[model samples]
Target: MTKKVLAAVKTDVETIEIREFDYPTVKPESGILRIEASGVGGSDPELYRKAGHVPVIMGHENVGTIEEVGEVAAKRWGVKSGDRVALHEYLPCWNCEWCMKGDFRLCMEVDFFNVKDRLNTDRFGMSTANKPPHLWGGYAQYMHLPLNTVMHKIPQDMPATHATLAVPFGNGVQWACLDGGAGPGKTVLVWGPGQQGLGCVLAAKAAGSYTVILAGMTRDQSRLDLSLRLGADYAINVETQDLEAEVMRITKGRGVDVVVDTTGDPKGEIVKQSIALAAKGAYLSLNGLEQQVPIGEIKKRYLTVRAPRGRSYAAVELALRYIGSGRYPIDQVCSHTFGLAQVHDAILATAGRGVQGAIHVCVEPWK
Candidate 1:
């Protein structure tokens, strides 16, 4: 095995630098992963642009092969070298109530943003890289997999590039189907045509929703078109058309049964519109950075507002199954690929800046 590992480290806001780290020595309770693909999601841009934690390696959605597994880790994770896996970002304390309940994503110990003192928290991609065994993120050739790391085995037939989608797909299943209650004969309105929004489109459709309407801006024409191809009943250009009027017309004035907003638009215009577009008693699954909501309107509509945090263990398992099923052309969502050297450009593409018509971007360390 190589003694040194290369990684794209986010040294500061809107900045990335290639750095090298000593290969981590696998302890009896830890392992190592040779990263194949690291997905760049919508939040990646925000993380890149915003100034918070510096000197962190920021690739959360990771897929790779197990390179080194300690004796205890091998038995604990039920895997050995050469096993393909998808790594979850959260590293929870197993003793917590949430962790015991299998909702490790909610465990407070892994809440890096809320907790102070970097050593106390350990979230992949978000934690500072200054710590020892600093391979904490996926923008690297190999990542250290501590015993607390949560991972799902990818099907043998699925390629690493496709398996990189498990994060968004898991979120889609969690928000659209599980939380939003989208099912047979239901109507869903997805307020963005980005990767997460498109994933929700597929999740709603797969759950037997009769109508799935995906709304986006003029720049997202290609994404909107792709939504239609991936089982969306309608793709609305919110920039060109009157969103409320079009939605009312499609629902015959009743509004949709569920509304999922993944735009992460700080203006909160879509959140306001979602209130008017939702059917009475409908569920609204919201995933955004910041928003100003009209609480009175939500209360009047009796809407069940749900904030989807992270994917549950079951959701990740289901996502792997969905990815392996040969269902939708999910590979198409991976619109751009970049090497470790082009980490900055890859993030720019994900942020809709450098690359045109880019959707889901992947960073391949070895490339």
Candidate 2:
């Protein structure tokens, strides 16, 4: 009999079922990953609430050890059995224009947003696992690694749970520092105190920004406070206090040098405020999926807007080293961990519906 791997499969709306799958056969240019800590992303709640995506294993922020690696894969990735690694969710076709331009995250072959095909492995966990070799997501005890899978080697000493943060932090470094021009002598503001928002705060401060302000609603005061402790210079309660007044005062009416909104504001209110709060010739990164943004305002303000999706490979490598630096209280950000069977609870905790003060929720597939 063939060995079977256990996985917490997303079977329906707000549902997860324990299912068994045949252990994937590692062919040349392919591998298998024994999941260590699969970080539950902030987006999981929205994904869980949606229907029609059932039968997909839904953890994409994966960190694991190389359980099995084919000869070709081992040579290509420069890794062997037992090597610790973190995976970027994208599995890009190298021949595409996006991949050739180094923005492989936007490759159509793995564009989960637009394309629909289970076999394409478009952004990992978004694919259907009903087909054969169903170990495609990190929620499982073992995940299949195809030829195009982007894997990064993590430090051996880094705790698996902490290593789970590589992707989010990579997003931070990518959007805040690299794209938004956050660094010394710049004042940066990040709206939303969620995992990605806090990552931006850490990135801004680490890059030696003159000031780092985190803005959120009064209900998010706890997370806002936590952001301060994580090195943010200021935490604004937008509901209780005047955001524009505070930002102007903080910047001496010059406005901020950089602004990145991770709030995913559907109303695009933050997008307006971002333009209003940006200094002349500022950089604004709207990570929020808002479509109603005022293009005219951005042009009038002379703001350079960047809409970044995922991290670049360089950012992930830097983020991993930053995570291992023992600088910030990252443990505070990683507040909860659940076993494979507790995936439902884990997603709730990440969504803030289950656990109180939940910052970064993780799933230990083996536990």
Against the true structure, whose TM-score is highest?
2
lDDT of all predictions, in order shown? Answer: 0.87, 0.87
lDDT tens per residue, model 1, 1-367: 6599999999878999999999999999999999999999778898888776678898999999999999999999999899999988999989989899988988988875578665346788888899889999999999999999999988666888888888988888888988888999999999888888888888889889999999998999999999987789999998899989998999999999998888765676777788888999999876566776678988899889877687888877877787778877877888889999999999999988978989999999999
Instruction: Tell me how far the alpha carbon of residue 71 in candidate 2 is from the true structure, in angstroms, after superposition.
Output: 0.4
* Candidate 2 lDDT over residue span 1-367, tens digit each: 9999999998889999999999988899899999999999977888888877778898889999999999999998999999999999888888989999998988888776666544355777777787667877889999999888898998788889898888888999998998888999999999889888988998889889999999998778778988987779999998889999999999999999998888777666877788889898999887655466677887788889877688899888888888899987888888899999999999998887867888899999999
Model 1, runs deviating above 4 Å: 117-120, 287-290
- How many residue-pair clashes does candidate 1 contain? 0
Residue range with the least summed lDDT across 10 consecutive positions in model 1: 112-121
Error of 1 at 267 (Å): 1.2
